[model samples]
Target chain A: MPPEVEGGETTERVLQILSTSARLFATTGYDGTSMRDIALACGISKSLLYHHFADKDEIFARITLGSTRELVQFVESRLPEGAAPSLRIRAFMAATGEYFQRYRWAWIASTTAFWNDPQQRRQTERMLWRDRYEGLIRRLIEEAIAAGEIRPLDVPLAGRLVLSALNWMHRWHKPDQGMPAPEVAEAYFDMIFHGLKR
Target chain B: MPPEVEGGETTERVLQILSTSARLFATTGYDGTSMRDIALACGISKSLLYHHFADKDEIFARITLGSTRELVQFVESRLPEGAAPSLRIRAFMAATGEYFQRYRWAWIASTTAFWNDPQQRRQTERMLWRDRYEGLIRRLIEEAIAAGEIRPLDVPLAGRLVLSALNWMHRWHKPDQGMPAPEVAEAYFDMIFHGLKR
Candidate 1:
């Protein structure tokens, strides 16, 4: 069961727990982290941590599900309605990068964690959210193709090409490095949209 | 020191040990796997496993270094000496796919392992090989730009764009699944070479 969110205080405390857990999981990796470690990191007693989360797996599941939900909502909020397909696609990429930068640790934890455990409800739900995100991108590409803004190519392949560049950033894109995530995403957008032909 | 290879039989036995260890590390993850587990999986005694290598770290390091060396050689051997920069890039990608298929587990383990382990010699050496591989691609891009075969752009960024798509494949591309890696790579190459815009 999901943790109880009794009120603002309880919700905030839960968020704090999740935030600390995400950082631990992101840096040390899921296997290396434990509930005891999370509690210690959060300066809470083990009983208190367990009061909020049943176990490490539940905490991880909560973080992954919450991160993906926020990602979808953030991207949807930024997508411009009635804009050209290409602009909409660029907007999608930019919004994704912005979200990633804002929640770098949580995003990393969610993306890199092993989510294929046997028929777990939380894992299944997270996959559904991921599918929604992918579907949204595919629809944008399909719209672009139909409008003749882009070449008529394989829709799934096109979607993967675009998503691959954006998705792989967490491995290399430093949080406070040379360029911000959104700008780096724009560079990728330019490359994908404009062929390298001189 | 590296494992001793006294003769052809010893070399083959070491290869067998490395191959089994690679598959375990690839599937169970480096941390999730144990030296004893590797020995059990290999149907060998713990003493025999210890005789081959010091520990799991050494086995992982050997697999990573060997896989990278083979990758460099395979890509270089496939590269056409006088071909256009574009064709050469395509060849480089195709060769990577072939190598990946041939040594799927080893490639997966090497690429996904946490290599930044505080200045260990094997990890450091593996990073050097990885750098060499990246440098090869960057030089190829530089040649393409100089030859006027492609638009002059941020060479590193362009290289990242291409590598990201190819590198991200291990996550979603299953062995014996929908499309072969080379064909998938070709589609990516086409989309990257000719921009999505008509």
Candidate 2:
């Protein structure tokens, strides 16, 4: 049984299991931890865990979906259309970059596993994210091109290039090292916007 | 127990094992694989596996070292210093990015768990690579700035930013998509070096 804080809804319980699972999964990789371990860690019985989630696969899919939605919402809300192309691009990437700081493990796990045994759910998640991110970047490239703020390049490929830079933040960034996510994002934004010029 | 293929002292068996293991480690993740499986897949005895590599960790170390050396060599070798600053910067990033295409998995693996692990050997490899890559980048940036190619910005940070773009290639690129790595790098090189200009 999950904590009463989740109320009596099974979906809430599933979500609870998922949140706890993501935290645990992030620390211990998916293969290293077992369902029994997850159930024990989450304070739920095996049957109840099964009742809420069919298996680890189901839970991972659910968590990934939630993560994708949260990312989309985060970026969409942060974007101010009326801003200059440069500013808009900064805001856009910064929001996503900062969000990655909290949830870097998801990226760590998902990105490393993109080509390996991509389950149907994982494939769907990949498509959704790639399309959404590419679409957002397409707009940025278009705006920048129109304003002559940046150089003309393939929007989809350019988006991939920018996303690649932001994606690695989780790999090397350490919060205790005194760098905040927003600051790192700004550094990257500065690199993207102005480059290494005085 | 290991097939001694005729070739260089490294041996075809050695190369086969390395390439296969690299893919397995990248796909299944290091934590998910076992020596038994690797041995079986390579058609070698576990003892033979040990002959070629001490153990799983050693294999991991070699892969990291091998890929890093390849990267360091490629960057240093391909970046012609006498070229114009604009051309040099673009060529430098393009060559580096092109490396990401074939060894995308190796690059991603080296930069993450291999770098993050507290193990001394991995750490040493990480530092070696960090210094080798960053040192080259610093030299290039200094030259470019002195030559009045780009505005003087933080060289170290700019190096990291540029690298992040190239490293993320493992996540999004698909060989089946028909876009060659060189072409991809060229496209991104234009975006990074020239910016969005008419």
Candidate 3:
């Protein structure tokens, strides 16, 4: 009945539309899902979906931005200020596994295989984790070498490899398979943290 | 000029078709690629392309089967008649990175992302890498621990985690990016073989 009430309802509806769209996209996939599917899944009209998102990519970008925001915030908190090379490296690798479980997004990361193929759409979301964290790992690697914590090697390469190992876990890990998330995180840590060599 | 000429021509054509198809599928992705695309890329007639492989899936299967064979053979050779645990584990991890690089269809391993989705037509091709390599890694983990090479942990989880880390390199690694393959392998090996703790 009132303009303010109408505006509030429209914004709430738009949020509802995006929240549902993201969950579906992350679970099903970006290409596999249809706008109609999102509309039906959301129990909303197509026109209402349009009012919220210009197209699938619009909704996808919004959802991706939302996920990245949470991820950036999580990284900000999980990584402590001025932790040591050994501790920071552990945290860095652990963040990979832990973040996936925390966000429930290994599927989203892997399915879209976001790093490759699409050059520009929503590129900022993909870089959020790497840009925020790789520098820290690079510094830790350099510091660790100087402190004799580990061997001298390229920092960025190691960062990518470590991230790859953690990111790839989403391809095989099924929470329903009785595999504990902490165990996966710990095993990865144990193997890489101490080296598999005796 | 008869049998030998025909046999050589057949094999050449087959190999040509396979390389073209693999490149196309790897670049454009499988769903976006069609018989026409492959044929056009190779400048071969559709009828002749049919002679080389029955369809896209058949060509795709050949690509996968070939990769699986290469990977399995490499690991099997590495696991000698009486090879030591340390050597076997190192060689296994090394071979994995190499094998993943060789195969164009390695992206198929990201099936869980699109598990229930329609593009997952080549599910077997994707799962085979994990099934074969994870089994081999599990055996290696057990042997390595028995031989006092690794910390005590669940073998299966350790194996999957290790494979996840090593094989997932394809996600970020591009040969054109100036990162050498050996260096990448060693970067992982450094973190894995020596660790970061002081």
By TM-score, the best candidate is 1
Instruction: Compose the digit string of candidate 3's lDDT tens values, residues A24-79.
Output: 76666666678999999999888878877778876666555555555545555666
Ranking by lDDT: 1, 2, 3
Q: Of the pair 2 and 3, which is ahead by lDDT?
A: 2
- A82-132: candidate 2 lDDT, tens digit per residue: 888878888888888777776665555555445443367676865687678
Candidate 3 residue spans exceeding 4 A from truth: A1-16, A93-95, A105-121, A146-148, A176-179, B1-10, B104-122, B125-129, B176-179
| Model 3 chain A: ten consecutive residues of lowest lDDT | A1-10
In candidate 1, which residue pairs get closer than 3 Å at backbone N, Cα or C atoms, i.e. clash?
Answer: A195-B195
Query: Higher-lDDT candidate among 1 and 2?
Result: 1
Clashes of each: 1, 12, 1
B-chain TM-score, candidate 2: 0.85
Candidate 3 structure quality by residue, lDDT tens digits, B4-112: 2123444766777766776776665556679999899999899988887778777766555454555666667666557776567767776666655655343442322
Q: List model 1 lDDT by residue over B1-198, tens digit each.
A: 123322243476687898899898888788778999999998999999999798888788778877887788778999999999998988888888877877889888876675234227878787787788788888998899899989999988888888888888887888898889999888888889889998
lDDT of 2 by residue, B26-126 (tens): 77667766888788878889998988787888777766677777777776778765787666666777777677766766665665454234367666765
After best superposition, candidate 2 residue A169: deviation in angstroms? 1.2
